[model samples]
Target chain A: MRYSGFRVIAEALTGHKGWKPVWRDPAPQAEYDYIIVGGGGHGLATAYYLAKEFKQARIAVLEKGYLGGGNVGRNTTIIRSNYLLEGNEPFYEFSLKLWEGLEQDFNYNAMVSQRGIINLIHTDAQRDAFTRRGNGMILNGADAEMLNRDQVRALYPFLNFDNARFPIKGALMQRRGGTVRHDAVAWGYARGADMRGVDLIQNCEVTGMRIENGRIRGVETSRGFIGAKKVGVAVAGSSSKVMAHAGMRLPIESHVLQAFVSEGLKPFINGVMTFGAGHFYVSQSDKGGLVFGGDIDGYNSYAQRGNLPVIEDVAEGGMALMPAIGRARLLRTWGGIMDMSMDGSPIIDKTHVEGLYFNGGWCYGGFKATPASGWCFAHLLAKDEPHKTATAYRFDRFLKGLMIDEKGQGAQPNLH
Target chain B: MIINHPILGPRDAQEFVYLGDANLMGRPDGMTAGIEAFHDYLYNRDNPAGAHRELWYHEQGDRSWLVVTRNTVTHEILKVEMARDVARAGGRSK
Candidate 1:
């Protein structure tokens, strides 16, 4: 049912029993025109756009578990389009635009807060780099502003301004970058896709792929064999394992990245802030808790839990950034597997197998790229061509030495 | 996590640096095998969810490269061997 302020008042007056389930839990169909594996944010969004935008029919999304149980729910919820590389900047900017209009379009309250994001600048070299980055962002039609040390102090006076080393000199601010209610994104897209005749099949694990001469067939799942004319795999960290079923190896590794939240307190942080010299980035949630995270657990592992050293490192970075938050008690910490690519950028392209597409290698930044990743993957699946903004996330780029290494770290997934 | 070093009894995981999949040690001859072998060596991985043989450098300790056979799911270390020995066994020479 469509929800609105008027509906709320009517339901309140009439015993409030008129609410309906957000999406249908449909049984697996015998066949489908298109099937998207893994019902995370990217998969759900792909199904949503395929039905709504592309007007495709006979679509199905098969999830191993319930929707939103993956990285969609296991993130710091920060969103931004502030990037430097040509292959990445435009795609993320498109995602930011989608986040801007997402709630209204999907008819859900996703809490898309454009409260701004600031990347602290420490050294003069960082200042020069951020200046170039700001110009690049502006060139891509994304908002960017360079804030001096005084300006940054005016915004967040509680920050450690004058440290012996790594003092905050300035900041690169993006007024449109902020956080979203991540779970609502999954629910919104699920509801939108289900409303558009897409079957969202949960508890259905794809066991194997039935490839006849590699020209596309269907998938064998825990439930049964489900036939599909086309198949798209958007499994984030599980991308390598799932694609391995089709005898294709991806340039991706699964690494655990942990996030933490502090106990609820009065809102003090104005926007998302990142430590210039370290890996810590934090933002105050709508529930008044400080949600923060740092670097990934620099190793290859599928375990959804991290070790202690990274935690200590992140805590040290947080302490170095802001001493006031030291007193706040940490409420909880969780980890999500990251699809860290060799080049640190994502890959959203069709594989060597015809009719089988892949979209993964998002590393730790998959949460912010949800909309554009889905939209681009949907465009590729529907039109059999790469989206205009995402033309560079191909598999052959690594072989051609045209990798989109944003950090300039070569071939090291852990470093990326 | 503790890595039982072959020389040193036990070392904290923080004292080492992780370079992914031990397959990286099997560096293909680029001039002889061409781009396909190089691409496979540089990119693809056997990222199993169970026991994984990976390369770790004792950067903060002995500066020795070691191979650790550990379970990815449980983070349990099964075996540790000097990477030089493993590489030598695989027929690599200076």
Candidate 2:
């Protein structure tokens, strides 16, 4: 049950590495040069890059909940750079590259297991889409492969090869994309950022945005007021609420995304496969748990728990993909809110309000884009220009009707 | 094989009705009935990735209720939880 894909991820993030500090936020701060809201993957990664790349210390990240308690901790922990969009392709490729050296670069165990990610294609049209994504990955210099039905069977040999409904047609394989330990990822970035003089303020919710004369002055948090010249809003779920304080509304709706984990068993799945035909994807964790998830909750809600239909549909898909896993027990399940956007892409751009930037609407792949999101968001925060790769993801695209919705899920997946 | 999932593995499926938004990817209404059919009814169109239907789980861990979003034709699952837990938010369309 060994897959080169799984090994690539395992070595990339979690291959035994040297020890490091157990990252913990000391205390809240009264002032900061840069105030970041939300302490999830994007927030922590942004703080890390701000210090590592921009050489800017004295940065503060304020979180409403525990550090990494947001989407970073709740995601299915899959990583891939198989975007077909013009901008998302290279940005995600960069993220995959960043994930490769996370352990060595941060000196923390992130458990990045490159179990390989395959998107199943069920038709000629889907195959074409997969090929386009593969080409995009190649253009971005990331590893991508287009696999036919026979090729897929040769690799796993346990798929529902003949299911007429969602035939095991073809797949787009990215050997570099896989899974990472959610908590270790947060700890790694947090430790690295804090070591560089970044302040991580946990349990401190920013209640208000301070803007004066068309410029950001500080953030009003529950603990105290933290002043900064530049303020970045990284809260994915409560984006509208935070941005509303600044008289701005992003093209995002808060939706719940649920995922499930099956009870641990002997090693079975060595790689990850996404049933692109439906919202089904499966990856076996190091603990032998089969982690599965799909499509966001079909409505807008701040609630963390998701509906049951998605769970049933996802489990049924898992059963079809790997008939042998039918006997495996699912252990527990959880849900997280995502700021799904009109285009099903992230909005990492400078807002009309100077000194106030937005980084939300990650749909379902925020975990994979942590590094690149921060990297580009940092570029924008420093120079105040849309990073070249994230240029199309501008907030204005929603208003202009020039949405980059490759998924064709429309503005909302449910309405579509 | 009997899949033993933490949520779905422990229960015996009870009687349920077929309610489909009957979107582009919905399953035909004339498939089958009963537990196996109910299982398919619950997930077939609301899961797998491209499903567009609503599902209701009548029986839970031990007679509790679970509602879900699912697919019918492909039997792919989307969201599953206690009927009470999935956020009961505003009905306004996003």
Each prediction's total of clashing residue pairs, residues at least 3 apart in sequence or on different chains, is 0, 53
Residue-by-residue lDDT tens digits, candidate 1, A293-398:
8999998888899988888899889998899988989999989999999999999999888999999999999999999999999999999999999999999999
User: Tens digits of per-residue lDDT for model 2 on A1-416?
Assistant: 12245555766687535333456556866677788888988998899988998888778888898889888889999888888777678788888888998887777778888978888888898888778878877988888898888988888888888887888887888888889998888888888888888888898988888888888889888987888888888888777778877877456656678899999888867888888666688888888888898776564455677657678888887877778988878799888877766667888888777788899878777889998898888878877887777787787675556677867766443422
Where does candidate 1 clash, by residue pair? none
In model 2, what lDDT does residue A288 have? Answer: 84
Cα deviation of A265 in candidate 2 (Å)? Answer: 1.5
In candidate 2, stretches whose alpha carbon ends up further than 4 angstroms from where it belongs are A1-21, A413-416, B1-94
Looking only at chain A, give the TM-score of model 1 against the true structure: 0.99
Q: Per-candidate DockQ versus the true complex?
A: 0.86, 0.03
Q: Stretches of candidate 1 above 4 Å error?
A: none
Error of 2 at A290 (Å): 0.4
Cα TM-score per model: 0.99, 0.77
